[model samples]
Target chain A: MEFTTSQVIEILGTIAFAISGSFSAIQRRLDPFGVLIIAFVTSIGGGTVRDLLLGDTPVKWMRDVNYCLLILVTSLLTIVLKRHRKRFTVTLFLFDSMGLGLFTILGIQKGIAFGLSPGICIALGTITGCFGGVIRDTLLNTIPLIFKKEIYATACILGGILYFTLLFFNLKADVAKVLVIGFIFALRVVVVRYKLSLPRFGY
Target chain B: MEFTTSQVIEILGTIAFAISGSFSAIQRRLDPFGVLIIAFVTSIGGGTVRDLLLGDTPVKWMRDVNYCLLILVTSLLTIVLKRHRKRFTVTLFLFDSMGLGLFTILGIQKGIAFGLSPGICIALGTITGCFGGVIRDTLLNTIPLIFKKEIYATACILGGILYFTLLFFNLKADVAKVLVIGFIFALRVVVVRYKLSLPRFGY
Candidate 1:
């Protein structure tokens, strides 16, 4: 299988996600192993969910040693930087938004590969981009950001739609990925900067 | 298209997992929506896990409305009987153990269908049968049962191996399921009764 540039970006996005998760665990006063687990889960959890949805076995992380090492290194870095967590949240969120955008496209691409309809692919993309954070927040006993603040996961959905919509116009795959990621990142930036929010329902 | 006796037991087990999860959520004083999420996840989590491993789509609950309704009923029951949660833990454990054994077999069966060899099948079975509880605990911000006292994901792995071993002798599938569930359930009972413990790793 070709590890395209987009796939490489996807891995970096995963690493960034792991950092976000590890920082959360560190703030909660968890031990190093606990930190690593949180990092590992938060980074790859969504992709793992997507893979499972597509019936891919051994998961990407389980198949690739690099993902595991990324989480471990991030965890160690988290422990070393425990004193600076509050200041890191904003920095982490930036990386996370990038991850969100990238994973969304990756998930959509996988769904397409598995022959799912475009509608399902977009939903898969949204889930892939957001579910890891949901799992992380839930584990930390906080309300998930996806359900609360920012235009995060929703941006991913819109971008994925744009991806397929652009593809229908016969846009190149590389260009489609760039356009979707750009859309998500910009949407997230505008939402965060303006303090925008999604409407919440208790049910 | 045979609904093997094992399949029947697996359904019952799913119900058990749902009950346990709902009850646990009550002990945590979750709201109604929280209860439903917990119950639904508990019931379908393992099977959903197994299906994901097999690269199945829509997970299991998304396909069948009954699974959702069953979990809904359990959550409703929990809301009604919130006062008696401690008393219900025993009943929940009984079902959980049954669910554990049945899901284990289901996982192994799915693995075999995927043409996996016995070793991976057992591992998949063990993961399917246990990961849900791990997830539930992680969501609750508690250390998982895997790190604490439990006889095992215990019965599932043993029963998985037993099922494949029995198949080596070409025993009837129904008879094998009964034997495996019975043995696993008995082992669980004995373990709980004696307060059995695994050797702990020092942190």
Candidate 2:
């Protein structure tokens, strides 16, 4: 009945992603239903994809109504806090970074649990960390930030490698998880702060 | 083992979708790798999503290497036909319609297999028919055809309803499927020919 640390991270990440999605919808001046749909998809799209690829159906959100409620509540909060949008920008960045880090590790862990190859696990981790944004951006009719030059998926991949490396050396699972998450979080913060990005590929 | 009519339709649909994806990539002037990736994802993305939501894992393409080979071959064919591109527009439209029809029924059947509600089944069918194009258009940095005035998803939904209605009346499965697929295909052809489209929604 007790929520594990990992579970707590997942919940927090879902809320963060949902808020970001709602923020995007508001920015785009979408209708209320559109805003809610965007928030729901952004919050759960990546995990839903990972679960589907892993053949784990009925999906996580469907299994627990709490996650849906959490997303709904987070999205509603965005509407209330719209007037103080500038203040929420800092909160958005923090939550987004935390979501990216936690989701990356969670994805890698799920891949490992499924007994997938290391390469596939890393890919899965990256997909889990970034695909929701891709879906969100696609729906919003903008180029996905990650695909452009955000250094987002890169951090997830690096963290995934670090995670497996630590596990290879027989490090404790919790310690490895914390370190990997920290690495991804720090990497993203540093990248954004310095305006570092991958070089754009020209056609 | 001999392939059933449904299985054949599915294979043809995959090939058709792959060609459409490759065509989009080529038009966008993507590199060879990008073209291949687009083709592969477009061919398999929808079903992969449907499977994931249904909790069926290892995904269909991964379990069957033939699909990958099919996509690869289809993409290569596109490259060859590129020089004769003017002759291929009609071909593209036909293949695209066939893909839409096949994937719609396939998705609905999968949803039914998973014991989902009728409404969810129709939604699954529409997603299966339309999401690949969504992903392809997103990757190509264009608005998805379905989201525009195109009668894309609408046709799928209508066909799906017909499919279920026929089944509800205890129609033979193969007959119902063929009728549904034909309905979608014909609807698309008619809508495109008549330049009929849904009214655009403005914020």
Candidate 3:
């Protein structure tokens, strides 16, 4: 019963998004069912979109009920832990960024498997990293952060480029994967920490 | 130079959604580029989602460049017709409802092709009918009308049920398809005209 590295990353990412979505839903004062639905969507949304684009049918979650159970449990735990609401924002951000990093790499790998071009793979990675949050925010009736803030997708794109570059330099696959994930997570944290944002056009 | 019934319905649905999307974007004060983008998503978003769920690779627009061109033309035409602003809302509703009916039948056909259960086919039909508008409204930062108002999806669902019933009664396939589409379009118009709405839970 050994889980491959990709499997591990996927599980971790799922949990991270589940936590992120649950916190956001609870913050919005959604009912428990609504919170759970948000958690479920945030956990599986990106991968589902990625699979759909690649024509991978039955979608991952539809075939694997375990992922659904995992989200249910994780969301319930997050709800039960709401007494520690002081750290809500930080917790949600951290988990979301972590999920973004992990899911981006997974999407890139899937694209590579499908023989998609490098640029398309990077686009897929960015989509996989950002779409879950986009769906979550959209369902919550807010402008998606991806459209409002550029750095979110930027980090994933940069991480994708770094992955390809590392592989070009003959870096071990596992090492490059870990490095790219850490790079994305750290980049997002630094950008937010420094209050960095792209200039917007006044419409 | 010959076209099948399905192809005609698909084209009509695409054009209808493109108009619906462009009008929505223009009303939201988006620029030309933004309007076109919204129109593209509204025209293809549901089919893309349905294909992904069914693992249909390359999706429709990706494989057929003609659809893209059609959407582009349709969107531009919609923008040009913008000066008829007084009738915008009514025009949008008419095209949207027509697209919903057309796309719903197409989706149900696809589901049957895949040998999916009737229930699942109906679900797919509803998704195909409604998701483009859902995506368009979400991108525009509005609560998707499907969630806020029940009749949107309800019309699709009822039409799906009607299609199966018609078939069960040995109605010709072509006749049933046309009837279902007209039924959905009329049902939605009547629902909105009468201001009928499902009661909401005050949670």
lDDT of 1 by residue, B1-203 (tens): 67756557666777778877887777677887997888877777777776765567767788888768877886787678667545776875776677677677777777777776676677678877877777777776666654445565646656887888899999987788778878887888888889875442221
lDDT at residue A25 of model 2 (Cα atoms): 69
Please, what is the whole-model Cα lDDT of each candidate in the order they appear?
0.76, 0.82, 0.88
* TM-score (C-alpha) between model 1 and the true structure: 0.58
Give the poorly placed runs of model 3, Cα more than 4 Å off. A1-48, A56-142, A149-203, B148-150, B198-203
Q: Pick the candidate with the highest lDDT.
A: 3
DockQ for every model comes to 0.14, 0.19, 0.17
- For each candidate, give the interface RMSD after superposing the true interface residues on Cα: 7.1, 5.2, 5.6
Better of 1 and 3 by TM-score: 3
Score candidate 2 by TM-score against the native: 0.60
Inter-residue clash pairs, candidate 2: A52-B52, A55-B57, A57-B55
Candidate 2, residues A1-203, lDDT tens digits: the string is 89987897788779878987887767666655456667888889899888877868778765566777788788887776677555554655666677788888889888988999998999998888888878888798876868656688899989999998999999998899889888998998898888898777588
The DockQ assigned to candidate 3 is 0.17
lDDT of 1 by residue, A1-203 (tens): 67986678677778778878877766665545456667877888899888876768757664565666677787677566556445766766786787788889888988998999999999999989998888888766777878766777789878988999999999998988988888998899889989988777796
Q: Give the per-residue Cα lDDT of candidate 2 at B144.
A: 73
Please list the residue runs of candidate 1 whose C-alpha ends up more than 4 Å from where it truly belongs after superposition. A1-3, A81-83, A168-170, A198-203, B1-51, B54-203
- Proportion of native contacts present in model 2: 0.35
- Tens digits of lDDT, candidate 3, B16-107: 99999988887777656567767988999999899987878857665566887899899988776667777878998899999999999999
TM-score of chain B of 2: 0.93
True contacts kept of 3: 0.30
